[model samples]
Target: MKLEQVSETTWAIVDASTYGNVGCIKLPKSVIVIDTGMTPPLAKKFRKLIHKEVGEPITDVILTHYHSDHVFGTQVFQDCTLIASSAMAAIYPELLNNRWSPEGIQELKEYYVQNDPAFAEQLKDLRIITPTQTFEDSMTLGKENEVHIQHTGGHTAGHSTVYLNTERVLFAGDLVFCQQYPYAGDQTNNPLEWMRAFEEILKMPVEIIVPGHGPLCGKEEIQIQLAYFKKLETWIKAQLSEEISLEKVLQTVDSSPTPPYDLKADPRLKFSIERWYTFYSQDEG
Candidate 1:
């Protein structure tokens, strides 16, 4: 795990060179970790890295969403209060334990371990972790220090983020990703709603933003991400008017908007485009 200084109290643990979303952050009064890495070994390595850097254990662990990649790491920080959106907190157990899950990520359920040798043995033997506390829309933290935790759901039903009022940093979770187009596969992903949340983020006087996956970013990146959502709106509108196919839409999209990365191989693009189309088409219907 590599750490980056976003601000005075804000630090990010970058997991790998590629798909570096497996990271966390430390605040002044309490430390808030973003998504846990995809498995136990990665999570353990992450904890060691954090302890080495902060010189103290994690006081709080926030799982942005219930994806196996994110939640499997929660077990590593049992000493801290496991936090997540009420919706996310509720959905994790069945999703983790049951052979069948709604998201249908059987490959991640079955073969992610194979892909990452670290996950090979650890994940198979882990126990279920249901969050002790839950919140509906928004929550606060560091009351003595006036820190805030905001829930801006869109990517998933229970997707949430942390906003540290002190450092003016926002942990965007999966609602906003860096560089690549977003993954909107869940039933709760409303492009319109997601776009609004993106817009709302602009209202905060945040200096830095930490994403669930990828690098820690600044204001310009936030605008770029918001623009991506807005572009989806425009593209989806074009599709509805012209009755274009998904492939045609892809072809029409030049420059890709997802810069510094080739999103063609990423499966998230297909689902993201589909969700974007639905948001626009629903209005016509």
Candidate 2:
């Protein structure tokens, strides 16, 4: 767990490497948390850190999206108000029943333990909680230290982001993947929608973009990710024009947006390609 003070009132807590990041800002009366960490223990650690820095109690836990990595820690902030997009709220029941059940969460924790023991230990005392407040398009909080939460659907149907109106900082959620491979698979995952979200982001008066994963970044990462998606689209279109089979497309299309990274071998990368291929192929038809 690494924390950086972006400003006197704003801070970013970056998890180990590619894990989801959390953001917090000090308001006149309380601290506003963007997202809890991936698990209870990690969220507890972040909660403690924020209390120490802000010297105030958390007033709200604003969820960026419904992904387990972002919202699974909701249990720790028990007393604080929980907030999320209406779209996310609409899907929470489904996610809880199908994806985030105790068995499902335990399986994911075990997988993480297999991959990295240190990170998985945070899964201990796991408790799942849902948002009590939700909005459709956008919402605002604070009088002096204002923050804006906007619905930006790209990564998911209900995906949203946080904007510090005064600080000019954007907690971009998964709308922008700084250095990690973007997991572009979900019932609502659409690369085009994701790109459109970026266009909207470009117009915002933001200087720093703390991505959902990877390190804290700037706008240039948005450009690079956009380029990646564009290249991916072009590659898929060319393959379709050749009348190639899906398997052949998988075989020939270069999945890596940059060199030396064999993204084709990564499961998330494969899922992303398959999802994009299916969507574009149907749209082209």
Candidate 3:
């Protein structure tokens, strides 16, 4: 497994193409894993990587959400408690059973075959897990070191973030994507509600952020993302007040408020824009 040392205590084994991002957080009581990459087979290999890095077994596996990429690989650890948000555990089975998402998934499968054929073979029969223990708000793991996992679902209904209080590192799941546009195509996506969720994340006192898809970033990057979301909300509110048609909003708004939003250049932007118009207007009415 290719590992990137994101911070002092956090390491990311990222899926370069698509469908993977597994992080390991070393806490005082024990090492707590953030996400479980692709499948049970990959999870076994991930164990070796973790043992090599921390020289200890993963005491806990905390899944940030129920998306296929993040939660499929939970069988590697021998003696660890698997965790998922209460909301995630509730709806996880449905997402796993329906395997029609070839677009995002193909990216990872193609890459894994070339880089790690053994792992690709292992991901063949996937195992989806329900949280052994569930929490409504925030939860902590490895109390000696203090890893505070904050639960704020958006992007997916049970998405979560993990924080190391001493290290001040946050493992932000699908709540924020790095270079590409976020997928808000699910039935659970609520654009305006997601906007409110972003507000809560901005209030976190964090120094370093390990996003679900990209490299670790600073608090300033978080501010920029928050600002982008704030602009989106304001723009939507203005359109509603002006009594403008949803079509106009869809045309005017691009990927984001900034110049590079380039709705025409990226196909994914259409879905995001449509989601915004449909969701917010319904809320307004």
Question: Which sections of candidate 1 miss by over 4 Å?
Answer: 15-30, 93-119, 242-265, 282-285
Please say which candidate is ahead in lDDT: 1 or 3. 3
Question: Which regions of candidate 3 deviate over 4 angstroms?
Answer: 15-18, 96-122, 236-256, 259-264
- TM-scores of the models, in the order given: 0.80, 0.88, 0.79
State which candidate, 2 or 3, has the greater lDDT.
2
lDDT of 3 at 68: 69
TM-score of 2: 0.88
Which 10 consecutive residues of model 3 have the lowest summed lDDT?
A: 255-264
Tens digits of per-residue lDDT, candidate 2, 1-285, equal 667898668888765522578888888888889888677877788888787776687889899888877877789887999999999899878867876778877887899889988877877678778899989899999995378899887898888999897878899988876777778877678777788888888887779888898777888888777877788778777777777888876665454354113345556776777777787888832
Error of 1 at 228 (Å): 2.4
Instruction: Please give, for residues 1-285, the per-residue lDDT of candidate 3 as tens digits.
Output: 676777787877765422567788875546788888767767777777878876575678898887767777775553678877788787855644555244435656667789998777766655445678778888877756378877777677777788887777778887766654566656666665566766766676777777777656666655665666667667767777799887776677553466123324566555666666666777742
Error of model 3, residue 116, in angstroms: 15
Candidate 1 per-residue lDDT over residues 96-165, each given as its tens digit? 5564343444544467566875655666655456676787887776646445666666787787777777
lDDT (0-100) at residue 74 of candidate 1? 69
Ranking by TM-score: 2, 1, 3
Clashes of 3: 0
Candidate 1, lDDT over the whole model:
0.67
